[model samples]
Target chain A: MTDRVIRLQEAPFDYGAECAAFAERAGGAGAVVTFLGLVRNDGGSLTRMEIDHYPGMTEAAIDAIAAEAATRFRLDSLLVLHRTGPMQPGEPIMMVATASRHRAEAFAAAEFLMDYLKSRAPFWKKEHRAEGPIWVAARDADEEALDRWAGGAG
Target chain B: MRVLYFAWVRERIGRPWEDVETTAATPAALADELAAREERYAAAFADRRALRVAVDQRLVDFDAPLEGAREVAFFPPMTGG
Candidate 1:
């Protein structure tokens, strides 16, 4: 059975603690990989970032993504944690962790989760700049990243 | 059905969600009905290519059937990471 943990919260998360707990729970897995996304100030004028998400849909979308990753990669465990609401530039926005019996499977699952989170999840971001707040546009690169995994084996 | 909006779409439409009663059979038909209601919706949905739709929390094409769908959400491409 594949273990899964998914969380969407407004408060900050403890990355180190979460990692340690996940490692403990994933016991005996040969490989574990973790990816963390941080808010970036592309224009150097970004003062804050705000995330808006559909309350009922966000968790459902992430759960479906995690389930797909587990089946495709034969993962032993998977964890996805994302933050919403106002945040600073240096704060952690999200994290994905995966465990598998092999390094390749673990790495691939983590990347897959990240790609889905970037484009498929129902979350929107707005950057609060020194001048004004602007909604961030979805990038073609992110879409391409997700498309690469389509109809492919783990 | 309940129609929901997010991001810039919500800003432009001036609300988060609304309850609508329509005879539309598909998301595209519903879009047409909403667009005809007011100018703000027309402008928000002016470019179908720029918007994405979800029926019952699953992403689908505009032509996807909305039969028995309790919720329909329209928003721009997701920018989550």
Candidate 2:
């Protein structure tokens, strides 16, 4: 079984440090790919952002998604770290890394994880703008991305 | 069952979580029951298309049976990444 590090934490994490640690722990994997998501200022309109996540479901959903990625990609391992609660502009929101024997598989797995996390996970983002706060709407494009994976076309 | 709300659902409902007692057999039915209670609930659940539901941490259809279920969460489509 591949190793999986799925963390749904409120504290901010160092992206560089987490990536370095994940790669090192990949253990002979030929490739490691990482993706990081940051809170954008939205042209100075965003004051900050609040991430409200279901405490129980967040962990359960991410674990299931990571497991699916590992199986489908024949992955060596993966890392999923996401933040919750209030966050300032430019702060790191989340990161996912995938390790595999081939770069293609690693990259594919990372993308798959991100697509699922965008809609499947239980975290909701409320963007606090200077004018007011608004809940970020789920894009139809995101849900559509999962369709490609289900088609087995990668 | 324990009913949970998140995001704008929570904001509209004015609570994050609450204990709810209902004889409704499905999430859709439970929604109707709650919506009948208050205008806030009616507004929150006005459009079922904009919402999602989970039972015991797993996503399920609104018509999914709630027999023996312990937890139900209702929220808008997730914007997580």
Please name the candidate that would achieve the greatest lDDT relative to the true structure: 2
> lDDT tens string, model 2, A1-154?
8899998888899999998999899969989999999998877999889999999788889988888887788798899999999999999999999999999999999999999999999989999887888999999998998998884321
RMSD, one per candidate, in order: 1.7, 1.9
Instruction: Report the C-alpha lDDT of model 2 over B1-81, residue by residue, as the tens digit.
Output: 999999999999999999999888999999999899999999999999999999998999999999999999999999999
Give, for candidate 1 chain A, the lowest lDDT window spanning 10 residues.
A145-154
Find the candidate with the highest TM-score and give its number: 2
Cα-based TM-score, every candidate = 0.96, 0.97
* Candidate 1: residue A30 lDDT (0-100): 80
Q: Give the C-alpha interface root-mean-square deviation per candidate.
A: 2.6, 2.8
Off by over 4 Å in 2: A151-154
